[model samples]
Target chain A: MIHQTSLMAIAIFLFFASTVIGISFYLGRKAKSASGYFAAGGGIHWAVNGVAFAGDYLSAASFLGICGMIAFFGYDGFLYSIGYLAGWIVALFIIAEPLKRMGRFTFADALDSKFNSRGIKLAAAISTLVVSCFYLIPQMVGAGALVQPLLGFPHYVGVIIVGLIVTLIVTTAGMVSTTWVQFIKGGLLVILCTIITIMLLVRGISTAPTDANGKASYIAKRGVTTVELQSMGTVVEPDGAWIGKKDPVTGDMKPAPYVRIKNAAGVVSVWRKDVVKFKDGNPDVTTFSETQATYTVNGKKNVNGLPRGKGEGEADLKPVGYLSKLPNGEKETGSQTPWGFLSTMQKSEAILWANEKIKDAAGVETTVYYQKPTLGSDFMTPGSSPTFKKVREEKFFGKLDFLSLMLALFCGTASLPHILIRYYTVKDQASARKSTVVGIGVIGLFYVLTLFLGLGAMTSGALDVSDSNMSAPLLARSMSEFLFAVISAVAFTTVLGTVSGLIMAASGAVAHDLASNVFKFKLDDFQKVKVAKMAAVCVGILAIGLGILFSKMNVNFLVGWAFNIAASANLPALVMLLFWKRTTKQGITAAITVGMISSLAWILLSAQAYKDVYGWDPATAIVPFSQPAIVTIPLGFLVLVLVSLFTPKPKDLAAVEKAS
Target chain B: MAGLDFKGSGEREKEDAGVVAHNTKLGVWLFLVYVLVYGGFIALAAFRPDVMKQPLILGINVAVVYGFTLIVSALAIALVYMKTCRK
Candidate 1:
């Protein structure tokens, strides 16, 4: 959807961005030491660190992607909310305290503290880089997505801007600035989302929602002028309708049975196609159908034709998603409670959007997005979307895919390098524990609000069917222009907070784990900090390039892959090291290597990747299911146990026993 | 070994060791309880979707109710752990 640039949005965005950059510059002095640069000098108050955890963890994917999914597919998106929040349980209960007690700088520090093995350092560092990079792609992509509608900039410009700002944030003050940025953004995101949810509940559900122009949101059918057909030959083009296809067997062009109307401004808009009838002795009659225009021509690059986006000489894609019928035939329900909202939605008929691809004889493809009036109960179930529809299938592999994703989400949080690094920023194990509780509370509240925000967008009559990620912001726009500006600005910071944290982890791995530990460099505190800042610059550049390159890809699934890899690779090593005394350095190294490679390989070879990323036939994918944690996580544990059984005890074990 | 001892040398280390062991034991038990609850949710969504679609409380179906419960339970358990565990 082409959004007119709003000065309000630009002003609000600049205000937030400048404030964040100001915080980074102010904190630059505190990060002169290695500990300060890497771990905020272990002095972040538990409360601030706790909100920052929410800020760091709630990336663009959480705010934009999940809400968009729920806006389009209802409860399936909420399934992600449930899975994601559950992972914090593992983080708080198992990983938080011990990790803080064990690690000094990075996740690798925690793993290598047991054996101080170079092999362990190398493997863990590589895993950290890989997971961080996988996680970075989606964030960069989301940055671009936001920039387009919010700032009226192209995708790459947004990617570069975020990349540069985050690099500056990380290079200047590292974790200190990163934590403060996250705290501010996280607090704002939760508070603003709560306000939006309250607004939506107060307004309640409406069957016929009007747009900014006071135009009725519903699209009605129109009758077209009759035209004569002559042996499937070329016919004179109609004044308003365009040819959608040529008869496949014949060379004759067929005008798609839709009518176009031009307003006083000469803006041409196409209405939905309904019926095309041919009488033996008379001209053919065509009638256009409901509110949405089904067929959209893929015009020349950046110059879309009528009824797609508001390009030159093109009509705007009508804002979609509203209730076609309310419960008991009521047109609107005003001022509902939270539970009352869900209960009302469970019975109403919502007009959702679905699209299909078709090709003309000229081989130009057109996407036909049409309205689908779905029962609230049906969409409110787990299998409303294609991604999770497998859960409704009888095939074991289908169900297993859903189960594996949940497992990855459950175990993935504690293993994420960025999340693990946050544990070290707090003062002690007690602080770490308290902050996690605080983190869970803040994050949990946001996830709950996402349900309302998404559902509210679904009925807001301002949905962009093509971009689900825009739903939350568009929902905000439906409420008020000021709210839209605030929500978009907050979301932009969401990307910044997450990207800074990931870069911090990546740079720490490169400097502390790879350069200092693995390569046996005798670096002082200043040198370590310098090397890490340089690494931050390099990683920031790489992230910007990847973000731009993968701009066209759907980024929601990449996050799932990150979780799978993080869980499969890091969890077993961290868990065994803390729990099992016999876990040798060789075991930790082997587990990290095997778990990372296997999950990565499985993801690359999985059906979802084949279809979505590689654009290949999914049937030929090697893996039975896309998510690898169900298999690779167990493989990690098994590899560690087997490798440890064969390796000799570390020399430090005897010394430690004697000392004890 | 009942607990892996990776702490540095000191009286503070010994004191933390006991607390860490106590917390780990309690954590593992709470973690298992959550796993059972979460596992039930995934299982029901996958196998018995019909049951998930049935109205459970008020007019909301089992899926929304169960999903909300899962999210609430995580925070609840975390708060429980924070209150009850040795800090």
Candidate 2:
């Protein structure tokens, strides 16, 4: 969708962006050493690192993706927020301090710390790179999605721009710059979203057609019947109705099968539907009016200022998400409390728009948005989207898939390479625990706020039917254009913050875990930093390409798959190494390798992959369901136990035990 | 033996091992609590979705309330762990 650029939006976006880049430059000098490059020299304040955790964890998936999901699918979207935040329990209580005590830089550092095995280093490093790559996709895709609206550029251009910017941020200063960027981004996102949500509550809900001249209000008044119509003869208005057909000269019915009228204003109205004959029909009934024209400027198609997404030329796409009917037959609900807003929305009627894809005579596919009147109560229930419908219906596959996805999310948080690395940035084990607590507090608050932000967007009267990713930014647009711009820029930064962290993890896997340990490169500190920087650039490019390819996917959904992979591959190895004395290096290597490969293969062969990636029938998929974690995670633990039982104990485990 | 055993080395090694054991025991206990609450919600969502849809208070349903409870409980558990570890 091509959006008209607002000067205010541009200025605010530039200001926030430049300040981030400026911080990276200032911190660049501190990141010259290997430890500083990868883990911020383990000197960052616990409080600062804590907020940075929130910043790193939130990502584009939490901000843009969750808000967009809730805006479109109601309460189903908030489930992701809940699952994500709950995952932190595993992080805080189980992983944080132990991880800090074990690792020097990367996640592999901790895993290999117990036995100092090359096989463990190789497998953990590969898992880290793969998981980071998977996580980076959604963040990059989110960056691409924001560009079309924020800068009036193509999606690919946006992806490339973000890739370059994030590469600079990562290569220049590594973890130090990444941490501070996340800190600022996390704080700003939470504060601004809160302010905008308050504005939504203050403005409250009102009936559409409140102002005739406003396009948003006009679309809201008409609902979804906004098609253009033309008459054979002169059309006359009877009883003040919007649609009319009468001959002005003879006062007789001049019905025609089809007619096109070209007005002097260069607007052509085509009434293509059959005209209905009146048989005691209400004259006050109105059909939506449409003005169609192929806009051109300077002999080229000018998509700028034109409505983007579905129903652009034919219909005036309005801000949707209003109560078509309220409880007690009230037309509108005034200002509502945070709790009240949710309660009222649950009981009222919202006009949620759903899109249908139709092919024209010329075989050009276009999406048409239809108004769906959903009860507030039904909207809050699960199983609205295909993702959760089976679970909501309590079917066997649905239940299993739901359980599997939840299990992955619960374990994935502590196991994620980027998140685990954050533990190393703090000073000590105590600091790690304190920082995790702070992170949990900040992230928990922001997630609660997303519920309102999403519901606000749902009824903001400004929804783009075809795109779920744009819901939050468009909701901001409805409040004020300038606010939309600021939020969009912040949302873009959300992507950058996450991608930079993911890239840092991947680069560390390459330089420290893979090259230095696995391949026995034995580089000095300066050389290690150089290799990491080069690795950062390569990973950044790979993220950009994947981001553009997966542009249409809902970011939160992609993050779910990534979570499953991470949980399956990394968690068992990390957990057993800490708790189980019999866990051998060979067992750890086997667990990571089998867990990673099996989950990846399962996902690639899953029904969702069959439909989305291969464009094949979902029924042809080999896997029973899309989420692989329910099977793979337990498989990881089992593999580790069995293998460890058979293998000889490592001499290093005893040595480390005595040294510690 | 290099004189490096958590059980045999010295008082400090014994203390460190005790701390590790304590941490592991506490971690498992908290994890079970997490499984009951978080896992319970997922089970309820799959098997008894209608129960989740039932109204709880002020027009909010059981699911929304439970979801918020999970978030709040996570924070509580974290604080509890932090305090216990310090002790």
Candidate 3:
């Protein structure tokens, strides 16, 4: 299945990639100067630019993460969609025209427009590069991830393919091709996803997901002690790194680093074997003597404790957290009201709502849990995007989570440099304003639909609780193969469109500012094109490498980090440049630099990084969490204020007149 | 709205406010209208969380019932523009 889909996905994507490359080439002939390439000579239609905003903004994280989240976590995923769309309110009212009126080609162009400080140029350029790259990594990872099931190729292949295709698209024409590509993709994705959702509602849940034997195309598996995990014809590590062979067939040479897990239970065991093409290649099934087992297996209990073996959301299968046959010591009447079950959880002192399991160094486990959310609705609780993360999940959360989520969405939208530069492509400030509204309309509708889609997936019995990213495509598969193919392809294109825009932004920053402004490398218009293309190639390669390395992280979680960085680093500087009359070169420069550096520093030292990357006993990070907007937004404003006060106004006052 | 940028800065300066800036003023109002629509929902959540539990006119809560009121405001703004545009 993986190989066939992977090949088909690759073939279609290549065809799409080539067609875009052709468009870029055709557009390039008309592009003469830096402005032509960077801003499409400021001549794109407003409607097209608006749709392009959807394309650029809806990254792999949006499609994969939201859908998967909805499938697994329910209403939590839909909340993300609301938060994301709410942000454009800021974009439409606050920053739209001011942005178009202020800048020439790039996001940095707007920030550096008021004061031609090399420092502002340097800082804004670095921030753009950093944010773009952070955003790019998730798309790259999604690229690799999507290729595995669709094209049947490895994740690395998918990453390389996207990197190459995006590089070709950007180098060919720059903003013109990128904009049109986004417009086409954005329009198609929203329409098609809506169509898919309608179909799902028409065909409601069934006991047999696809076939009657209760067999799923995908299922989760626990530890594999008896069976060997091999890669490249050799015994492999968890990461698929090749180790020396193990003769599990022979009793002698067992696989190195392989653990032994024994379970003694009368119940039948179901193991999801990749059967290849998935993690740990399928669990190698072996019958062992019951004596070595650590778990005594206190009978059978499902995630929600009902029947032993069946897909979730099946009619015969009980709803999760509602017991047909309760666990030992658990009591419930079948006739209980919904509110009774939920309200009891709210009052219970036993922590269930916000539970954390912590293990000390001596190998003792201590659990600290909250008991508020009883998973009554299951549709409206934590565990994914489009939903409020900390606030909706737990009670008594400080307003910090509420503010952080809103602030991330609000500032993240405008601060995204890819979304910003779209304004420069339109003819004027009015077009910028019009396009933003159009984008709001399109993006808003799609976000509302995500709730239905997420609900449909949850009920469809395709929600992989461990991995939410697979929710949408897997949900599509539950309905039909054709829908799965279409959804997967659109999801693939989602990554492609976003990564292309990001790479273009990064390339522009490197070529336009770092080369021309920082090093003072004087390149003619034609030479500038060449330099930008080279820069695209370099950034593309970097994104490809990072994407594969960080493939394990959820796309939306990574995207949240991107939002925090973009909001903290870029937003305050841009807002100050437009609104504040006293905004000096030093202020803009220092704000961008300090905001970027401090946020980046906080993320690296975060608890998430310690757990996921460092694999060490988690350290207490300086910031309350990795998200920096709560701290960094105010800091950027302060830096701008203090620096502007001390520094002299630039000799060039023309920027103030023209910018307005 | 589409080709306004082609007009020279001098042409723009010479032109009267003549419903263009009137529309611009309308735009400012419409933008504020949008803010109210979204902000109103949050306010309802904060101040009248219980109102969401009760039906307003229909079986829907006051929050759910008024959710479309915000979008309707956006439509009202859109319609106002359409009414005044050059035929």
lDDT sort, best first: 1, 2, 3
What residue runs in model 3 are displaced by over 4 Å at the alpha carbon? A1-11, A205-378, A381-399, A649-660, B1-87
The TM-score between candidate 1 and the true structure equals 0.89
TM-score comparison, 1 vs 2, better candidate: 1
User: Given the true complex, what DockQ would model 2 score?
Assistant: 0.29
In order, the candidates keep a fraction of the true contacts of: 0.64, 0.55, 0.03
For A177-247, candidate 3 gives per-residue lDDT tens digits of: 88867877898789978887667555533322332234542211223334432211232122211122346
lDDT by residue for model 1 over B4-73, one digit each (tens)? Answer: 1112221222335678789999999999999999999999999999999899888999999999998889
| Docking model 2 quality class | acceptable
Which candidate order results from sorting by DockQ in descending order?
1, 2, 3
lDDT of 1 by residue, A180-228 (tens): 8899899999999999999899888888886645566754323433331
Docking model 1 quality class? acceptable
| Local lDDT at A364 for model 2 | 36
Q: Tens-digit lDDT track for model 2 on A151-237?
A: 877889989988998999999888988988899899988898889889878877664513222454534333213233333233322
Question: Individual DockQ of the candidates?
Answer: 0.35, 0.29, 0.13
**Chain B TM-score in candidate 2, rounded to 2 decimals?**
0.77
| Candidate 3 per-residue lDDT over residues B45-65, each given as its tens digit | 434445544445433234433
Say which docking band candidate 3 falls in: incorrect
Candidates arranged by TM-score, highest first: 1, 2, 3
lDDT of 3: 0.63
